[model samples]
Target: MNKQKQLSEVTELWKTNKKQYVKKSSFSAYTLLIENHVLPTFGKAFHVEETDVQDFVFRKLESGLSHKTIKDILIVLKMILKFGAKNKWFEYTPFDIQFPTEREKHSLEVLTKSDQKKIMNHIQEHFTFRNLGVYICLSAGMRIGEVCALTWEDVDTDRGVISVSRTIQRIYVIENGIRKTELILDTPKTKNSIREIPISKDLLRLLKPFKKIVNPSFFVLTNDARPTEPRTYRSYYKNLMKELHMPDLKFHGLRHSFATRCIESNCDYKTVSVLLGHSNISTTLNLYVHPNMEQKKKAIEQMFKALR
Candidate 1:
């Protein structure tokens, strides 16, 4: 009988094979998941069964991991198992994992229009490089990483667009038993994320003068060669909100606020999806298209009137 290999052994083999095909960011993510979650649970096992995976899911849930995060971990786990099976290191079994039904809908945080306007006004008046980054986010639905990666060359004043092609993130790397963190400047989250969003007139006015003289290679947020990572920027944003006496919304709420305002203005969902660089229109719809009570009543009234 062939000796069954330990899961940890197969995992190292899989990583070596997987690294060549994936982006550095993706490879880093896979490695982190394996090291932090998968290896800890199943490294010593020769094979994992359905019950083992299901129990792991429950434990992850109890530890307050989100459903999406658990699902991502499972995707990595399944790939490792498949890799092991392909190499004849172990027998592979597919598991059916179940999650508790969610009774309450997840509410995304967003800024009220008045509050959004107040913040924008403040940024315009009290302009700083960091404050300008917040203004850009509100005007253009840019993620923190994307904003961090922005440079003067990406801002085209003549075309009135901001080109989004890259993002900056700190990733965990493990090499020869040494773990360290790396800050990477890589392509944005996905292909669709590499897009040009039209610059709003107000933001354009704010940027046009700077475009003339700023170094093309300088990062927009810093106006220097050094780029700010998301962690530092997020902390800056938190303090700005607190100083403004506004609700402590997460930095992502700036994105939600931009999308919500677009929807409220009755912009077409497909256009909003493209501007937001969503991979699919369905994602945009799901996040921003919830009908309010007034809309439901109005819809019913119009339906009855048409029937009559």
Candidate 2:
């Protein structure tokens, strides 16, 4: 019988073979999860049974990880085990492991029309360092992290467009028993996510002034010339929403607001999906394609006129 290899060896094989498909940051996350969590728990097992996986998941969830997080961990585990199975390190495939699918019931939270205007009004006049960032999120439909991580090279004022090639996320990294925050620059979450989104002429005019005002290499949105962490900005967003007397919403709610407005303006779901960098049109439809009562009524009237 062939000798079994350590977990690290298996991961290295995946990384080497999967380079074109896997982004560096994703590979890094998988590596970190395996080394810090999965490997330490199952390293010596040489072959993890399906029952072992079920127990690990139960313990992880009980330790307070959210369902989404546990699901992500499971994704890594499955990838590794399947790879191991192909390599013949295990006696049999570990296909019995499964994740419980719970319906995601939290309704998609979006900003009310009045709140959208009020927030825009507040930022337009206030014109702080974050003004450009806020404008991009509201007008360009860029996520807060994507806008914060953008650079001068990505912005083409002449073309009235912004190219989204990369994004930054803050993650917790544990080293030698201590945890610390690290900034990871990753490829956009999906292939379709890599796209060029058109910007309004008015938005371009607003940004032109900031070009000369802020450092070019640094992000368009930052006080100290670094990627602005989303967590800290969410608190600021909460305060702004409170001052506007708006319904409480997270920073991401702005992106949702953008998609909502586009649909209301008769933009097709596919167009909105492309603008938002969704992996596919189906995701956009699933998340934001519900027509409001007024729109439904209008649609029916238009249909009658067409039939007549």
Q: Model 1: what TM-score?
A: 0.95
lDDT of candidate 1 over 200-269, digit per residue (tens)? 9999999999999999999999999999999999999999999999998999999999998888888999
Look at candidate 2 and tell me the lDDT of residue 251: 79
Q: Where is model 2 more than 4 Å wrong at Cα?
A: 5-21, 35-44, 54-67, 94-104, 171-180, 212-215, 223-225, 292-308
TM-score of each: 0.95, 0.78
| Candidate 2 CA-lDDT value | 0.75
lDDT of 2 by residue, 1-308 (tens): 55676655666576567656866567667767776677778766667677887888788877867777767777887787677668876444545655566565657678778777777777778887666676678887888778767887677877888998888887655556686767887777788878898978767877777666556677666745566777766677777677778887777888998999999888978899999999888989988888766688999999999999
RMSD of every candidate to native, in Å, equals: 2.1, 4.1
lDDT of residue 39 for candidate 2: 73
Instruction: Give the range of the ten consecutive residues with the poorest summed lDDT in model 1.
Output: 290-299
Model 1 regions lying over 4 Å from their true place: 292-308
